[model samples]
Target: MQQDSTSKDSRIALGLALTVRHDGHGGVADDLADLAGLGAWLRAHPGTVPDTERYRADEPDLAAVRAVRAAARALFARAVRPGEPSPADAARLLPVPEALRCLNQAAARTPTVPVLDWADAGPVLRREPADDRADLAAALAHAVIGFLAGPDRPRLRACHAPRCVRYFLKEHPRQEWCKPSCGNRARVARHHERQKRTA
Candidate 1:
């Protein structure tokens, strides 16, 4: 299949940005769990990620996942347009699919969640991030979304450090440091230059 470089980079960057590790014992902090939950979503649905166990019950709610997925689709759909994307164009970009899923999943269970409170209101049960894994999940998801859809969209990019897979928005297009190895290489080269100059 033909690949869309821009979209692929965006997805990978967002995925890496959203990733969080889970303890699996349910004793971890909500914020960390939420972060991992967001990562899980990215893994599932870069196309249609599922709600993490941290966010959902054992049986899993297919309906909840689908609902969040749909909202994410709409957000992305509304954000894109044909033109030379300006800095403000970042604002035009909606939260990607993963962010929308996190938020929607949170909203499905709460009316006063952090980001969801001012945005939408309904029964949603008013659950806390601790009580509602969905809330934390949503927050992490939205973090990447908000970052990607800001005036800094131009900085968003994927890591190019050999086989190391990660994403980074460059501070300058000329900067190529993404992993420690890459940064170390650059540092070593700079040290060599300094020695040669002094010699």
Candidate 2:
């Protein structure tokens, strides 16, 4: 159960991080570029965060989520260690320390308490919000924190395929790129580079 929850949280966090992607023109694209874009994204992935269904995202909400995404991407770059991060945002990533502070602050914005949830199997301790207010940024930050600290952290990776600025959890031991299309692109790019060198 815990593993499942962790995986879900990781997926959500990765989803947030992936908002900044390659623009197909060797530049970065932001999915949360404006309130409309943020609203579209929220509608696309409904109910992932706390109070998402009721999330009345304003300008500030968009900015907050974008900040979280930037921090998440920066930390992702740091996570892969010696390996290269996605090239799309390489030059503009937030410093690792600042990213850490940003994520920490966002997560701490909302307070939660561990409450006993009775289930068919047994009673489980679940973190419940202290108040009724909806803090989408805080909830998303909490998901990112859970993912960063979960068991699958080691499997987290930033895809390096050409024009692919996405992060994914390795599904298998041999997994490299985030998707098959990315793998094909990477292979074709590598082949092209090799041919150029030989030429």
Candidate 3:
């Protein structure tokens, strides 16, 4: 079954957008290779899959998925690290109208059902059955919208480690890298620079 993983932490969508990483030098790596890989990734990160049964049965359109992923990554990169992307780069992002269309289609297919919430003492709404591919597109679109409008949007950052190109939500004011290892690498690089300057 498809679930909303971005409800609690919208960053999950950003993580998905960043599945394809670049070294910023010349190297690149794509984590999602095929439908099976996509399924596995979704299994590891539940709520990402729209309709598990459909996903398991059908072969995903790899070209379409890659196009969406590329557009998403471009948009995120522009938002998080402005001034680095050229005009041509920005033009490659999926147009707002197209993204909205995908979102709307998903919403139309999956209506919301209202239910009483005893714990919260209110009425809650849950999404109906998700159409595998449509839902995935909607989820990605929703996440992008949420992240762009979120208060923590300014905290979105790409890792500064050399040869590493991963985005992360900055947890601390001083955080500049995605992980401790990236931080260590930065420190080591700085140390080498200092030694060269002294020599």
TM-score for all models, in order of appearance: 0.34, 0.89, 0.66
lDDT of 1 by residue, 1-199 (tens): 1134344435533443323112234221222134345445545543322253334322134333333433433343334333122231233334565546565455445344344344365534433343433443344334335544664456544443322223344555576655467567557768888999999
Which lDDT tens digits does candidate 3 get at residues 89-168? 34445665665554445435434445445556666665444332445544555556566667656767767675666667
Judging by lDDT, tell me the better candidate of 2 and 3.
Answer: 2
Sort all candidates by TM-score, best to worst. Answer: 2, 3, 1
Best by TM-score: 2
Candidate 3, number of clashes: 0
Error of 3 at 161 (Å): 1.0
Q: Give me candidate 1's TM-score against the actual structure.
A: 0.34
When 2 and 3 are scored with TM-score, the better candidate is 2
For model 2, state the Cα shift of residue 17 in Å. 0.8
**Model 2: lowest-lDDT 10 consecutive positions:** 1-10
Model 1, residue 118: distance off in Å is: 16
Error of 1 at 149 (Å): 1.7
Which 10-residue window of candidate 1 scores lowest in summed lDDT? 20-29
Q: Which stretches of candidate 2 lie over 4 Å from their true place?
A: 1-6, 118-123
The backbone clash count of each candidate, in order, is: 6, 0, 0
- Give per-residue lDDT, candidate 1, residue 190: 82
The candidate, 1 or 3, that scores higher on lDDT is 3
